[model samples]
Target: MSNGKKILIVEDDSAIAEIERDYLEIDGFEVQIVDNGPAGIERGASGEFNLILLDVMLPGADGFAVCRKLRETVDVPILMVTARQEDIDKIRGLGLGADDYIVKPFSPSELVARVKANLAQYERLRNRGGAPKDGSELKVGQIAIRPQSRRVYVRGEELTLKNKEYELLLFLVEHVDMVLSKETLYERIWGYDAIGDSATVAVHINRLRDKIEENPGDPKVIQTVWGAGYRFKA
Candidate 1:
């Protein structure tokens, strides 16, 4: 059985951190707050957090760097927070392996809502069963995916993929040869249509290619259909 959820808040601003922590704690989550990127990474590596609320602008390393490092060791969901409302920043955060993004001056209620939604999705995936025993793995040339186990194999070697990445890859594989629009993908995977920017999908696609494609510069498994969206070739 899953225990009480643990959330890590990585925000340099004490006020914002406190506000998020207070609300999440009231919702029955255990919250840990860290002020800088390096410290956040250190704590995150301990594998204690079920989810992370990371601020974009942080002291000593920045949220992107922290997120990248944390992904190297953990599969916890990361929700990036930023004061900048630019699409480029959101894309950057997603590319660095963050699962979601929220802009500053956001409604606390909405933040809590997102947290709950993400946690629910995570739990659902966790409770799902293991991979099939038959040779029915989704294979895209050299890359193979087992949906039930949430595992990816590249040339027979296991590849570590975060929760969102694995889901995105599986979705694309399941819909092989069909060009899926970014809006559709966002709505399906995130449980809501992405607002303010669609570059978040682009970033994730790029990251997924980097991991699964032998030549990310010219991806073959997950192809981008110009003026449309993305598709799986095999």
Candidate 2:
């Protein structure tokens, strides 16, 4: 049912874009490519795609700018592709609402895996709209989440969360008080082995804390377990 999902590839390099498109199409995805940022954003805003594979450096607006703009208009998953592996770049990309990041020199297998994982997860979330079987809720302290509706409320006030942020929070909440290592969290949430570092998990953790924690600087709800990883305090 998930095959033939439409994906937009916003890469400036024709060769690289073609390679990505070819691989994804071979894996049963319907792929579209644009070589510049403005065109990417324009197509993205139309909500015609299930996901987007965006390159970092572009002609009209750079990937970060394109991501920020796209997030304003659409809720589809965005995965930023770049040659830069710096933590800052990854953090910035995730902060701009990208669902994942793939550094250059990545394997075509890994790329296909990422696209499939993201599209599947997005489909699951989009389809989960019915009420829970037992009217159960996932709650940690002042934060409450209804999995069926995909709604989150902190302190009785609903808070907006991007896709990965919601997934990360739900995972932590499910295993409340258990310290989960970055590697474990990455594998569980991303549905793939960590190809690089676990910086992606750390970025999403910080973003979630900022939204649900009383003080993001001194997070009380989601505590860092010092060398272990993060724990959601229940």
Candidate 3:
């Protein structure tokens, strides 16, 4: 599932981290283990890792704080590990920019799958949709996306987009006008839904609209289909 791609595991539990490392290394990924939140934040923001597996309960900073700090500058996929079964914890992690959450006691195979999925998604976005590219700019309504630079523009003005927001927009634009359900969008974009909730997708959609739409309150570019999902009208 990997080709020397580096993954940082920030877990205080040595056993869990070692198990994760062994599985990932066996899959051809380079693994780095950090036992604290501060170190994780430091290394994770260095732009050296393709993905990060962060634990919720950590010394120094905790997963939530580390995630929030990392999201300030890092766009890499963050998979949170938590033992809490509460919906609030999962929701908080998602809201804090975690790409996925794995509840503790998850099987090693499942963890590997989640890691592979997030890494693949990250690679797709980084590689400009992973197709042999023509370096073309995709235009939809007033928004423009330069595949080469992975940059987005709105009405001739550049707009900064977060990782998930950009991925969501690109996906919608590529399948423009197609009514995609939440489940489809979530799976295609997120790759995994440990919490089995689509709120993260909704959050990203709103964020994308806010960045690319003329007015987010009444979005025209990305239209919401009540009782369904969303469509890229633009």
Give the residue spans of candidate 1 off by over 4 A: 1-3, 130-136, 155-157, 194-197
Off by over 4 Å in 3: 129-136, 192-196
Top candidate, metric lDDT: 2
- Local error of candidate 3 at 65, Å? 1.7
Q: C-alpha displacement of 10 in model 1, angstroms?
A: 1.5
Worst 10 residues of 3 by lDDT: 127-136
Tens-digit lDDT string for candidate 1 (62-104): 9999999998988778899999988888888887788888888
TM-score of each: 0.85, 0.93, 0.86
Model 1 — TM-score against the truth? 0.85
lDDT of 3: 0.86
Write the number of the candidate with greater TM-score, choosing between 1 and 2.
2
The per-model lDDT (C-alpha) reads 0.83, 0.87, 0.86
